[model samples]
Target: MLLPTLTLLTCFLLIVTLLPISNHTHWLIRGLDFPRLQIAIAAILLLIFQLIVLEITRPSSLLLICVSGFCLFWQSWWIVPYTPLFPREVKRAEKNSQKPSLKILTANVLTPNRNSQALISLVKQHKPDVLVTLESDQWWQNQLSVLEDDMPYTIKCPLDNLYGMHVYSRLPLTETETCYLVEDGVPSMHASVRLSDRVRVRVHFLHPSPPSPTENPESQERDAELIVVAKSIADSAQPIVVTGDLNDVAWSETTRLFRKISGLLDPRIGRGMFNTFHADYPFIRWPLDHLFHSEHFTVKSIKRMPSIGSDHFPLLTTLVFSPKAIPENEGIDASAEDRSRADEIVEKENVSKSEIPQPTAHAK
Candidate 1:
C-alpha cells in the first residue's frame, strides 16, 4: 500500500513541475511558475524516501526513480540560478570604489492594511534615496506624506484600485512620467534620476497584476506590460534600474524574456531569492518583488526588510553606478527567437503604446 501511494504521489508532482513550460496564459498554468523552489524541495525529499524505504527491485520501480530524478533536475535548472552555487550576474562593488551609490526602498503596502506608521518607520530607518510603494490608495498616499520632506522628488497616482503606485525620491528627477501600459487602472512610473552632477540613471517602477481569478483571469496583461517595458529600455545607453512588485517570480519565462529583451541583470542571481511576499506565511513565500539593473551598476548591498504589517516585506537595495565595471558584467541579450516571442506576446494584447505626460512632482 505504501509503495503504490508513493508512486502515485511522485507522478503527480512530476506533472505539476512540467506544467509551466507551456506558454499558455491561463491563470492556473502561469501560477505554477511561482513555486518552483518548493516543488524542487518536495521532489528531493520524495526521492530520498523512496531510496531508503522502498527497494527498487522491480523494473517499474527503477523507471519511477529515473522519472523522479528528471523532475528534480528540471525544477533545479530553473531555480538554481538564484542560489549561491550559480555565478553572480551582478558584480559586487569594491569597498574602495568612489562611484555614486543609490539606495532604493520598495514595498507593496497592502491597500486594505491600515498600518501606515509601520512602513513610515522603515523609511526613517533606511533613509533610502528613492521610495516606491505599490497598492497604495488615497489613504496610503495621505499617510505617507510625511516622507515628502525627505524625499522631495515625487510622482503620485493614488487610486482606489489595488494598482495605485507612488514614487518618492531624494535625488532630482527629470523626464518623469506615470504610464498606463496595459490596463487603464494599472500604472507604472518611468523617470531619469539625477544621481550626481555628471551621472544620470533611467529608472522604471512596475507593479503588474498577477494571474489569479480574483485579480486577472489570464497573465496576458501582466506578460505584455513587462514586454512593453522591456522593449522600451532595450537599447538604453545610460545606466538603468527597474524595480517594484513585478507580481511574477524572477525565474518565470516572462521575466527571463524581460531580462533578455531589456538587457538588464538581476542582482539576486547567485546571492539569494529575496522572497518578499506573504510576509505572514514564511514557508509559502516566493520572490514577487524584484529589482533589475544595467551592467553599469554593481551591488553595494541588497536585503529583505522586516515585515511592516503588510503581505510583502519591503526590499532595500543599494547599487553603485560604476561605468568602469561594464566590461566585467554583460547584460543578457535577446536572441532572434526571444525577440520574436516578445513581439508575439505584445501583439496579442491591446497595449497602450503612447507615453503619458509627467505627473506633478511634489516638493516640500
Candidate 2:
C-alpha cells in the first residue's frame, strides 16, 4: 500500500511541475509559476525515498528515479539564480562608497487590513526616501497623511476596487504621470526622481492584477502591461528603477522576458529569494514583491520588511547610483526572437480606447 501511494504521489508531482512550461494564459497553468520552489523540494524528498525503499534494479524503479530527477533539475534551473549559489547579478555597494543613494519601501497593505499604525511605525524606523502603498483606499490615505511632513512629494490614487496606489517621496519628483496601461481602474505611476543635483532616475511603480479565480481568470492583462513597460524602457537612455508587487514571480516566463527586453537587473538574483507573500502562512510563501533596476545602479541593501497587516511583507531596497559599474554588471538582454515574443504578447491583449482610464486627481 505504501509503495503504490508513494508512486502515485510522485507521478502527480511530476505532472504539476511541467504545467508551467505551457504558454497558455489560463490561471491554473500560470499560477503554477509561483510554487516552483515548493515543487522542487517535494521532488527532492520523493527522489530520496525512491532510492531507499524501491529496488534500484527494477525497470519501474529506474524510470521513476529518472523522471523525478528531471523534474528537480528543471525547477532548480529557474530558482538557482535567486540563490547565493549563483553569482550576484547586481553587485553590492562598497563599504566606504560614498555615492548618491535612494531607498524605497513598497507594501501591498491587503486593502482590508486596517492596522495602519504598524506600517507607519515601520516607515519611521526605516525612513525610506520613497514609500509605495498598494490596495490603499481613502481610509489608508488619511491614516498615512501623517507621513507627508517628511515625505513632502506625493501622488495619490484612492479607490475602493483594491487596486488603489500611492507614492510618497522625500526626494523631489518631476514629470510624474499616473497610467493605466492595460485596464481601467488599475493604476501605475511613472516619474523622474531627483536623487541628487547630478543624478536623476526614471522610476515606475506598478501593481498589476494577479492571475487567480477571484482577481483575474487569465494572465493576459498582467503579461501585456509588463511587456508594454519593457518596450518603452528599452528605448530610454536614463537610469531606471521599477518596483511593486508585480503579482508574478521573478523566475516566471513573463518576468524573465521583461528583464531581457528592458535590459534591467534584479537585485534579488544571487542574494536570496526574500519571499514576501502569504505572510500569514509560514509554510506557503514566495517572493511576490520586487525591485528591478537599470545596470547604472548597484545594490546597497535589499531586504523583506516585517509584516504590516498585509498579505505581502513590505520590500525595502537601497540602491547607489553607479553608472561606471555598468560595464561590469551587464543586464539581461533580449534577442531578435525575444523581441518578437514581446510584440506578440502586447498585440494579443488588444487594449481598447474605452478601456483606458481617465486622468486621476492627485494630492501633489
Candidate 3:
C-alpha cells in the first residue's frame, strides 16, 4: 500500500513536470513552470526515501524509482544554472576596470499598495540611477514624484487597470516612449539612456500580463509579447538592458528563448534565485522580477531589497559595460528551428496596436 501511494505521488509530479516541456503556451502547462524548484526538491526527497527505507522493491516499483530519479535529475539540470555550482551567464566586474556603471531599482508596487513611503525610503537608500515601477497608479505616482528632482528624465503612464508603468532616470534619456505592445491597456517603456562619455544604452522595461484566473486566462498573449520584444532587440548593436516583472520564471522555455533571441545574459544565473514575488508567503515565492542585459555589460552586484508593503520585492542591480568580456561568457545560439518556433509563436495572435507617442524633440 505504501509503495502504491508513493508511486501515485511520483506520477502526479512527473505529469506536472513533463507538461511544461511542450511547446504549447496554455496557462495550465505554463503555470507549472514556476514551481520547478519545489517539484525538484520533492523528487529528491522521494528518491532518497525509496532507496533507504524501502526494501525488496518489485520490478514495477523499481521502474517507478528509476523514473523518479530521472525526473529529479532533469529538474536539477534546469535549476543548476541559477545555483552557484554552475558558472554565471554574466561575469562579475573586475575591480581594476574603470568602466562607467548604471544602478537600477525595479519594483512592482501591486497597484493597490498604498505604502509608498517604504518604497521611497529604499530608493533614497539605494540612490539608483534609474527607477522602474510597475502596476503603479496616480497615487503611487504622486508619492514617487518626490524623487523627480534627482531623476528628471521621466516617462509616466498611470492607469487603474493594474498594468500601469513608470520609469524615472537620473541620466539623460532620449527617444522615450510608453508602448502598449500586447493588450490595449498594457504598457512597456522603451528609451535610451546616455551614460558617462556619451555612451548610449538602449533600455526596454516591460510588465507583461501574467497567466492567471483573474487577470489573463491564457499565457498566449504574455508569450507573444515577450517574443515580440526579444525579436525586436535581437540585432541591436548598442549595449542593451531589459528589466521588469516578466510574470514568467527564469527557467521557463519562453524565457530561455528570450535569452537566446536577445543575446542578453541574466545576472541571477549561477547565483541565487532572488525570489521576489509573494513576499508575504515566503514559501510560495519565485524570481519574477528580472534584469537581462546585452553582452557588453558585466555585473557589479544584484540584490533583492526588503519588502515595501507590497507582494513583490524590488530588485537592485548595478552593471558595468565591458565589450571585451563577451568572449569569456556563455551565449545561446538560436538555430533555424528556434527561429521557426519564435515565428510561429508570434503569428498565433494579432498584436497590432501601440499607443506609444514620438519622443519629444529635445528628449531625442
Candidate 4:
C-alpha cells in the first residue's frame, strides 16, 4: 500500500515537473504520442491507484507537501530554459521589397457560442486579408456571411457539431478542397491562392479533435493527420502557410516535429507563447491555436486577440515572403539534419489509412 501510494505521488510530481520539459524536447513529447486527453486520464489513474493501495497518513501528507514544494521550484527554473529568445541570425529578406504581405486571422468560434457580433467586430477591426474559423455551425456561418462581399473567396463547412471549419479570403482562390484528414466528417480545408503580387501560396487549415475518452482514446489519429499535413508541406513547391486551432500547443512535441518536418517557422517562439485555449481562464492556459509558415516568408507580427465567445482566443499573423537570408539564431535552422530527423519521425509513426479509427456519433 505504501509503495503504491508513493509511486502514485511520484507520478503526479513527475507529470507536473516534467510538463514544462515537454516544451523543449520534441522527441519525448511526440514519441510518447498520446494527446493532452491522456494527461487527464493518467491523473485519474494515479488517484485510483493511491486510494486502493495506501491508507492516508501524516507521513504521506508530509511527502505531498515536499512534492508540491519540489514542483514549485522545478517550475521556476524549468521555464527559463524553454523561453524562446530571438535567434540572432534573423536577417531582412532581400525580396521583401518585391512581395506583398499576407495577413491572416484565425479563430475557434466555439459551437453554441453566440457572440458572432463580437467576432465580427474583431474582424472589422483587424481587416485581415484572410480569416479562418473553427467549430463554426450553420448559425455561426450565417452570421459571418456578411464578410462574403468583402472577402470574395470563401470555403465553408459549417457543421452543427464542433468539427465545422471555414475559410474566407480576400485573395483569389485558385484551387480549394475540403479534405477529411483523419475520420469521416472531420473536415480540413486546403487551398491555393494568388496574392496581390500574383504569387501563388498553398494554405491548409486543420482542426483535429483533442484526445479524450469522448473523442479518440488514443492520439494516433491526431498525430497521423498532423504528420500527413507536415509531409505535404515538405513536398509542396509553392510557398505554404498552415493555420488553425490545431488543438495543440506551440511547445508540444508534435508541433515541434511538424515544424521541423514541414520546415515551417513559428513566429511565436521568441516573440511569446500567446496561450489561446480556455480564453476565460487566465492561468490554466496553453497556446492551442497556431500559424506556421514556410522559410520563404518572414513574420511581420503575430498577436492573440481579445476573446469573443469561444474557449479559445483568436490569433492574427502577418507574413511577407522575402528572398533575404534569415539569421541562424532567430529560431531553428531548417537544416538537412532537422529535416531528416523530422522525416524519420513521421515515417516511423505513419499509421495506414485503414488503421485510423472512425469517430463514434457519441464522440462527436
Score every model by TM-score: 0.95, 0.95, 0.95, 0.74
lDDT of the candidates, in the order given? 0.87, 0.88, 0.85, 0.68
lDDT of 1 by residue, 1-364 (tens): 9878888988898889878888789999999998888898888998888887776998777777888889899999999999899899889999977878999999999999899999899999989999999999999999999999998899999988888999999999888888877888999999888888887888889998889999888999999999888887776675788999999998899999999998999999999999998899988989999999988889999999988888999999999988778888855778999999998898888653344232222111
Off by more than 4 A, model 1: 352-364
Instruction: Please give the distance, in angstroms, between residue 233's alpha carbon in candidate 4 and its true position after superposition.
Output: 1.6
Indicate whether candidate 1 or candidate 3 has the larger lDDT: 1
Q: Write the per-residue lDDT of candidate 4 for residues 291-342, one digit (tens) a residue.
A: 8876667767778899897898999988876635333424343667656655
Cα lDDT over the full model 2: 0.88
Clashing residue pairs found in predicted model 1: none
Q: List the residue pairs that clash in candidate 3.
A: none
Q: Give model 2's clash tally.
A: 0
Q: For residues 207-248, could you state the per-residue lDDT of candidate 3 as single tens digits?
A: 989888887788888888888788877766668889999999
**In model 4, which regions exceed 4 Å deviation?**
1-11, 15-98, 326-364
Q: After the best TM-score superposition of candidate 4, give how far the Cα of residue 277 lies from its true spot, in angstroms.
A: 0.8
Best to worst by TM-score, what's the order? Answer: 1, 2, 3, 4
Displacement of residue 253 (Cα, Å) in model 3 is 0.3
Q: After superposition, how far is residue 64 of candidate 4 from its true place, in Å?
A: 12
> What tens-digit string does per-residue lDDT give for candidate 2 at 22-126?
778999999989899999999999999999989889988888888889999999999999999999999888777898889999999989999999999999999
